[model samples]
Target: MSSKHKYLNDWAAYFDETGKVTRFAFRFFREAVKPPYEFRELLKQCYVIGYQSLFLVGLTGFIMGLVFDLQSRPTMIEFGAESFMPGMIGISIVREIGPVITALICAGKIGSSIGAELGSMKVTEQIDAMEVSGTNPFKYLVVTRIMAATLMLPILTIAADGIGLFGSYLIESYKGDVTFKLYINKVINILSFGDMVPSIIKTFFFGFAIGLIGCYKGYNSEKGTAGVGAAANVAVVIASLLVFVLDLIAVLISDIFYEL
Candidate 1:
């Protein structure tokens, strides 16, 4: 094929992939809302996707806050805004860094794991077996995973925001010589509901994107083991990219509302 033809073909394929994933997410939501709630399966998925991910999320959250505070301190000090460090970092953490970083980490850990597990199931024909046995495999397997992810991610982000702030507190106290009481007051004063609400809301969209892409990639895997690996890799990549895109839109909306 000519170079132009190749480029067109690639673009077509990319659009097709995007559409397929969108349809898959729609199907998952449609099925999830129907009766016969997969309570047990949903709980199991929550354990697998959410509970299992706590340690990694917590560790990353703590480090994110610490590093952000340490790095920001010098910059703020140069501007003689040392007193506002806690407030600035608090707003930054709750509004942008905390949610985006947490979502990316979740995309890497939860997204990749879900993709690999579901892809392996597809490769081993286990998903087919469930379907053959007259089970709604999509509802039971895909729905549960997606729902678990949707619910778990917001909770995880909340925890991460908290942990990250605590980490910032520790670093600021030790490195910046700020008192705990003043730090707490500064943080509380600058961080209004405006900042907190948008951050939390963005996480929901991030979670949905991560789960939907991961499930779509795995459910549609093709080349056996090679496909399984590809699904996991692509799922993380797509989910992480979507996190930033969604974050951008969210910030735009937030800016409009706040008249900023």
Candidate 2:
């Protein structure tokens, strides 16, 4: 193909993929509410995606809180704003850092797992078998997984924030001789309903995007074993990128809401 022709073809391909994903999303919405909810599978997936993520998420949150607090201490002390550190950390963690970090972690962990699993099923023709055997594979598989992710992520974000704050408190206590009660008071006094609600609302979008992208890549996977790996890798990349995009949108919306 000529260079211009090839470039046009690539653009066409991108648009086509976007359309297919949109249709896939619409189908999910349609099927999600119809009937015969896969409660069992959803519970299983919640366990798989949510419960299993706690250790890694908690560990990461702790390490992040420790490192960020420690690094920020010298700066705060230099500015003679050391007393403000607890509330500052609280605001940063709860409002921005916690949800974004937790979502990114979920994007990597949950997205790749879903993609690889469904891709393997596709490659092995198991999904086809389920289809032929009179089961709604999309409902049983895709809807359940998506709903599970959507439900689990907010909880996970909350967990990461609380644990991260605790980690921050530990460092503050050690370095600045701050009491737990005072740190807690500072954080509580600084935070409000507005700060939390938007952070939480965005997480649902994050989870939805992650689950949707994972399923889309896997469900459409081709070329056998290689496709499975590619699906997993692509799912992680896209989900993580989408998290940042969603976070940006969320910030804009929050700013507008505050302005109103």
Candidate 3:
């Protein structure tokens, strides 16, 4: 195939994969709402997906804040807006960067892990065996993962925002000679519900994308052990890319709403 043709083919394949994942996500939600809920499996997934990744998320959040503050200070100072640093940094972090970064980290950690785990189960015929024994593997496996991700991501984002703010405060104190109380007060004053809500809302979709794609890739895996690795790799890539796409949409929507 020509290079242009290969590019078009790749794009088409990408869209095809996206459509399949969306359909599977909708079906998973429909099945998940019915009876025979897998509460135990859901709890386990939450533990693995949420609590287990807290340390990594926290570390990243802290660094994100510190580096953002360090990087942004010179620009703000050059513009004679040094005093506005806290609010500007806070808005940038909470409004977009914080949630998106946290989601990407979760995608790398939880998405890949779920993919590998489910792919392994598929490879071992455990998923198939569950079906033969009259169990709904999709419900127990896919539903729980999607639900856990949908629920836990908002909580994780909240934690990340807080940690990021703290990181910013520390940097501001060290470099700009800003006091903690004043910095925090500026952050609070600048942060309306408009800044917080849209960012938090987008994370739910990010979580859903991560969980659904990861589970779908693993659940429908092929080629045995190699397929398991492939599923995990693909899950992280798709989930991370989707987080950025959704974040852009969320920003546009938030702007529309704010104007109204």
Candidates' C-alpha lDDT: 0.89, 0.95, 0.92
RMSD of each: 1.3, 0.9, 1.9
What lDDT tens digits, residue by residue, belong to model 3 across residues 1-260? 99999999999998998798878978997998899999999999899888988889999999999999999999988999999999998899898888999999999998999999999999999999999999999999999999999999998998998999999999999988889999999999999998988888999999998998899999989899999999999999988988998888888898899899
TM-score of each: 0.96, 0.98, 0.94
User: Cα miss at 11, model 1 (Å)?
Assistant: 1.7
Off by over 4 Å in 3: 1-16
In TM-score terms, candidate 3 sits at 0.94
| lDDT digits (tens) for residues 166-224 of candidate 1 | 89999888877778888889889998988888889888899888888889889889899
Over the full model, what C-alpha lDDT does candidate 1 score relative to the true structure? 0.89
Worst 10 residues of 3 by lDDT: 17-26
What are the per-residue Cα lDDT tens digits for candidate 2 across 140-177? 99999989999999999999999999999999999999
Model 2 quality (TM-score):
0.98
Q: Kindly indicate the candidate among 1 and 3 with the higher lDDT.
A: 3
**Whose TM-score is higher: candidate 2's or candidate 3's?**
2
Checking candidate 1 for backbone clashes, the offending pairs are none
Candidate 3 overall Cα lDDT vs. reference? 0.92
